[model samples]
Every structure is written in structure tokens, then in C-alpha cells.
Target: MLRIHFTDADLARTRIASAPDPLWEICASLHRMQSRQGRWAYADWYRGTRARLHDTGMVRTLRTLLLPLVPRAAYFPDFLTPPEAVDGLEAGVEAVLATGKERVRAEIGILHRTSGAPAWAPRLADPELRQDLVHALRRYHALAIAPHHDRVQARIDAERAARARAVLDGGTEALLAGLGPDLRWQHPVLHTRYPEDRDLYLNGRGLLLVPSYFCWGNPVTFGDTELDPVLIYSLRHEPHPSALPGDLGSGAPLAALLGRTRAAVLRTAATGATTGEIARAVGVSASSASQHAGALREAGLLVSRRHAAFVLHTLTPLGAALLRANAPCAEPR
Candidate 1:
């Protein structure tokens, strides 16, 4: 009944920016996981695991798997928790299988009620199944944190109650409007599961929020991982290249510094190429490349060091990451 207009693809782009390599890797890994597990079974296991764990943060990990399926019109309320976290890989499968069975009964009850039938009939018919599911969930909780179950449950209960109060008072709306001036609202929330910060549940908006740490977790995973080509179509492509600071800025000198030749020299240097190689690559003379490279070194995009007769150029960590993201993948493997 929710009037949600956004799709999974939209969720990926806004949350998973084109620049971060780790974001791309997470998406690719999830694509493989879903293909092996089958979709419905995975979803059922995910929800039951979260309910048992009683920690919503576990749900945030799911974005790693769900990234590739962003375009699909499916709703996975809590497929964020991986099986390994709940009960190890083997136990997680068993848990999912049991939860899938209970889910069938729950779905039937909801359907019957939606048809204007007596909800009691469905509940009565599935009483035993419901009881068994509760027992299984309790078992999950036991395996989850049996040693600290009392303390953990108390915390989860408190947080759950607080979340309920926030929903009742429209806390979501206030959080979105930058209610607190010092909330670091500009920090840009990445894929996360903090109750009030989940925009999907709040306003049914396509925008996603995640912690920055999650975005930059694993960079090389993108190159080795396979992704669906369909994501290319899902992206909102720009018709023309965006202007650089020099082109878009008000001052003429600043715009001139951001010129194409200068930018290309910096970009090549960012990739660890020498000035001579950069000039050859960019179709400029070596001396011309040297001039631009020096400018970029001054601007902090390139670090130049004299090695023998050659000046070695390499990007700072920040420069390398930025360049890698904007550059095209060498070939679709």
C-alpha cells in the first residue's frame, strides 16, 4: 500500500556513486549471491535473522548484496543481514529454510485478510506454524548472543520502543530537513540502517543513506567481480561532460588553469605516468606536459619526484581514488 515510486536501480546510483571502487565490488558480489540462493528464499531468511538478532545495524550489510538488483521492483525490508552473521553459513541455510516455510503461512494470512475474510481463520489455521516459527526465532536468538541475551535484548527493546515513538511523532521529516544545525548533515550518510535515517522507510524516496566507511571498504573487488551490464542502462547518463572548476568558475584565470591540456596532464600524472609518457599519451610535447604537470603538482593533484634523469609522477591517495573512479573501465571482462 506504500506509494513508493523509486526502483532498486535508482537506489544504487544515488547511494553507490560512480567514483568508489568498493561500492561497485559489493554490488557485484550480491549479484552472485542471489543467483545461487534464489531470491524468495534469501528474503525470508534475511527478515527472520534480523528479528532474531534484534540489531538493525546488521541489516545495513545487505546493501553490499542488493546493489546489483537496484532496478528490480522487489521489496526486501531486511535482506541486509548476511547468513554468516546470524548462524554461520551452514546454520544460516537451515534457518532460512525453516523461515521460508513459516513465511508461506504468514503470506496466506495477509492475503486472506486483504480479501476481507476473517483474519482469525488464517491465524487459527496456521497457529502451529506460527508457534514453531517463534520457537525457531528464539533458537536463533539463543545462538545469536545467549551469553549476553538479557542485556542485548534490553537494549534492542529500548531502541525499538524509541523508533516507534519517532515514527508516531514524524521524527523522519525533521531529520530530513536538517533539524539540528550541528548534525553534520553535510557529511553525507552512506548505506546505513539507523532507523530514523532510512529514507526509504521515511518518505519512500529513492535517495539512500550509507556510512562513508562502507563505501570505501574494498576497492580491488570491483575489477575481479562480474556485474550485470544492465546497471549501465540504469544510470542517469549526462549528455555532456560537466565543466571543470576553471571552466565553470567566475574568474578567467581559474578557468584557464582548469583547461583541457592542463587537466589531462594532471590525470596522466595521477595514474603514475612520467611527464614524457603523459605528453605522448595526450598528444602534446614533453616540455608542454612538464609545464602542466608542474602546475598540477603545485595544485596537489600530482606528486613529482626526480628519479635519475626522469621525474616520476604519482597521485596522492586522494588523487588516485578520484582518478580511478572517473576513468572508464579498461574493458568489460
Candidate 2:
């Protein structure tokens, strides 16, 4: 069990990541490829990414370079996922490149000790070798992570909406309490099932809750305590093939959402709304609002998630784009 001890100051400082971290998603998706644990949830992505890698002849790079470094294990270098990743992938890769050679060597050594690393792992300290690693990371991300950006962002947005509602209704503590079944919040300590036994003392720095689309099984945190505190966790999987990002033009056309109620439903979900909230905003009954939301969701325009006592609805990337074309005015009713 991993126990994260928090303080009063920690509660005041705790917050959710405003957006998904690309580097963490890269790491998590690599783990997904290594294990079949949650394969059913990502079956489409799994098959597609594999085929893309093979077609691009990046299969050797994934097997030889990427997997060794990011093995679905208890430890991988924390430097690979820096705080700079919050900015974007380029910034994160630059951070990885700029990591001190000595520190890189040390972390690689740790990886060898914890989980067997490649024989050449320590050579990553060489700047030339590091560049090769960075290049492969970029290629893998393009083939795997980039194509699914919309679905990943949609899932993260849904999670943010749910957590934001929790924070407003209860408090930061409530936000922590509802971080999926993998996490347990009991007073000042948050517990989780982990590969190893350990405890993390927040010590007033608080924690950043990063919702990752690919993270599976148990929640993950940096093995190094010196870095800023963060918990990268997976969201509840809802396999909506129509909603999953990929394939060209698999969705209904925007003209299909020309109906007044469905367009209103899409617009109201711009900032996320419950069924009742959507109904009230669009001047319709709850069941009517639900049916419209369902229609929009099927049209790949809205993503809904259940939080506490309500099902919150938010716009998917496709949904948002279509709403701009169909409902130029912000006011729903």
C-alpha cells in the first residue's frame, strides 16, 4: 500500500491538472502496450498503434529503445516526465535532453537495480545517445499518442468536470475522496494499492492530481521524493467506439445535429452540465435533455460521466468543433 500523508496546508494547496500531461501519457501508453491487463478497454488503440509502428518500421525502435526505458515496472527515470511537461511535449523533451548527465546515469542505475534495464542504459548519460532516445520518443508518440489526442483530452476533460464539481460541492478533500476505486482517502492520508510498500509525506507542498487516459491498474507517482508531488491515475473506461479518436469521418455529419434541442444540448455542455442543469438551461424536461444529450453523444458531440449524484456532460473535441458551426450563439435556449 502507498500512503500519502497530507497536512492542512496540503489540502489548501491540492489541485487537479488543468490539462493532461503529454509526457505522462506517453509513458502510460507505453505501459499499456507492454501489458494486456486492460487490453479490452484499449483494443482499438492497441491494434491500430501496433499496425502503425510496423508500417513505419518503428517496431525495432519500440522493442529495442522505448520499452527498455519505460518498462511497465515499478520504476522508470522520473526525469523523463518533468514538471515542464505541463507546457507540452516539445518542452518536456527539451527538459529530458537538458537533464544532467550524472543524474541520468544515476536514475538509469536505479532502473537496473529495481527492474532489469538494458545493458546500455548507463550510456544514456552520453549526450549523443540521449538524442537518439529523444528522436525515438517523438516518433513513437506520433504513431501512438498523437492520433488519439482528442479521445485522451476528452477523457481528461470529463474527469476535470467531475472533480471540479466535487471541489465546489464539498471541498478539496472531496476531490481526493472520489479519485476512482484505486485510491482511498481517509482523513489526512490517501492510500493506494502499489507494487511496493511505501509512504509519501506531502509535507505541505500539496499534490497535483493528473488524470491520464492510458494509466492502468494502480496509480503511479515518481519514485524520487525530491521532485514535486504528483499522482498520475487512470480514468474509468467507457468504450464508446464512436467517440474514440481515429479513422477519417466515421461520425455523423454536423447537419445531423441541426435539431434545436440537440444543438442546445451540445452548447450547454460546452462548460459541462448535468442532465438537470442542461434541462434547466435549455428549458426542457430532464428526460428530454437526457435524450438530446444521448443523441449528441452518439453523433460524437458530447461525453458524459457520472459524478456523485449527477451525470455530468461535456463536449468532445468533435462536439466542440461542430457546436461552433451549428450554434454560433452561446446562449442555449
Candidate 3:
């Protein structure tokens, strides 16, 4: 088990990352490719990713470089998933490049001791070698991650909306408590499943809760406490979720009944999704999603309200009943 001790200030400061962290996703996605655990959840992504990697001739780079460095194990170097990744991939690669040589050596040494590293792993401290690794990461992301970014963003956006609701309905504690079945919030300490026993003290810096599309089974944190305290945990995935009604082909009867994207917009709003969330989830432009939502609101299928800069949409009774009649039985948890 891993325990995260938080102060009041930590609670005040604690928040979810507004956007996906690319480097962390890279690490998680690598683990997904390496392990069969929870493979069913990522069946589509797995198939697509494998084909992309093969077509791009990234097989050697993935095997000889990426997998060895980011083995699906208890420990991998923290520098690979730097906090700067929250900004974007390029910023993250820059952070990885900027890692101090001493820190890189120390982290690589830890990786080797905890979960065997390649013989060349120690040489990561060399700036030139780090550039090579960065290249591999970028290539892997392009092949595996960038293509599926919309789905990833939609899933993460849904999770963020749910968490945001939890915070508004209760407080920050509610957000933590409802993180997932794998995590438990016991007042000042948040406990999560881990391969080892450890404690993280977030004296006041708080914690960055990163909901990852690829992280599976457990929450991951930095090996070094001195780093920014962020917890990367698996986001719940429902195959063909209501939020992603667009996955059903455009010619499907449901699309014909409600006009494809409009129907997706409605389903996404079932959980009070924002206009932006609806746009991403249904693979439509924000203007399109807004127009669909406006039409639905006028038709009495959705209720919309302005909250801060976001307009939140929730399903009306008629809309819920319509969905219930058309929706399949809920997926088993």
C-alpha cells in the first residue's frame, strides 16, 4: 500500500491536471503494450497501436529502447514523466533533456536496483543519449498516442467532469474519496494499491491527481519525494460508453434517429458534460456541439446553465427516458 499524507494546505491546493500529461501517458501506454493485465479494456487501442508501430518500423525502437527503459514494473526513472509534461509533449521533452546528470544517474541506479535496467541505462546521464531517447518517445507517441488523442481526451474529460461535480456537491474530500475503487481516502491520508509499501508527505505542496487513460490497476508516483507530488492513476474505461456514442457508425439507426453528432451530444450531457466536453467526446467542433446543445435545450431534452466560463448540460427527464429506451443494458462493472 502507498499512503499520501496531506495537510490542510495540501487539500486546499490539491487539484486535477487540466490536461493529460503526455510523458506519463507514454510510460503508461508502454506498460499497456508490455502487459496483458486489463488488456480487454484497451482492446481497440491495443490492436490499432500494434499495427501503427509495425507500419512505422518502430518495432526495433520500441523493443530495444522504449520497453527496456519503461518496463511494466514497480519502479522506472521519474525523469521520464516529468511534471512539465502537463503543459505539452514538447515542454516535457525539454524537461527530460534538462534533467541534471547527477539526478539521472541516481534515478537510473535506482531503476537498475529495483527493476533491472539495460546495461546502457546508466549512460542516460549523457546528454546525447538523452536526445536519442527523446526521439524514440516522440516517435512512439506519434505512432500510438497522437492518433487516438480525441478518445483519450474524451475519457479524461468525462472523468474530470465527474470529479468536478464531486467537488461542487461536497468538497475536495469528496473528490478524493470518489477517485476510484482502487483508492481509499481516510481523512488526512489517501491510500492506494502499490507494489511496495511507502508513504508520501505532501506537507503543503498538495497533490496533482492525474487521471490517465493507460495507467492500470494501481496509482503511480515519483520515486523521489523531492519532485512535484503527482499521483497518476488509471481512469475508468467503459467500452462504447454513452459518452462516446459517436463510436457507433454514422449509418446506425441511432444516428438516423437523432442525427449522429446531435445524439452523441445528448448522451454526453447525460452526466452534465460541458459544451467543450461534448465537443471532444463526440468528435465535433465546439461550435457544432454548442449548436446541437442549443437545439436540444430548445427542444426540452437538455437543461443548460452557465457556471463560471463553462455552460453545463444535464439531461432532462424526457431525454433520460429516450436514452433508456434506446440504450442497451448498462455494462457490467
Deviating ranges (above 4 Å) for candidate 2: 239-243, 246-256, 327-333
Count backbone clashes in candidate 2: 0
**Residue 165 in candidate 3, Cα distance off native in Å:** 1.0
Question: For residues 1-333, could you state the per-residue lDDT of candidate 1 as single tens digits?
Answer: 111123444333332221212222233223433454233323433344457445645333343222322212122112122222233333443333344435545544443433332333234234464454334333433433343332222222322332233334544432322211212222233222221222222122334222111111111110101211111111111233222212223444333346778767756664356677898989998898888777665554555654335566765443444566777878867
Candidate with top lDDT is 2
Report the number of clashing residue pairs per model. Answer: 10, 0, 0
Ranking of models by TM-score: 2, 3, 1
Pairs clashing in candidate 2?
none
Per-residue lDDT, model 3, residue 284, is 85
State the lDDT of candidate 3 residue by residue for 64-183, as single tens digits: 999998988889999999888888999999999999999999989998898898999889999999999999999999988887776677566667777898799879998998888899
- Give me the overall lDDT of model 1: 0.37
Q: Residue 73 lDDT in model 2?
A: 83
Which of the two candidates, 1 or 3, achieves a greater TM-score against the reference? 3
Cα deviation of 329 in candidate 2 (Å)?
A: 10
Report lDDT (CA) for all predictions.
Answer: 0.37, 0.88, 0.84
Question: Model 3: residues >4 Å from true position, as ranges?
Answer: 239-250, 254-333
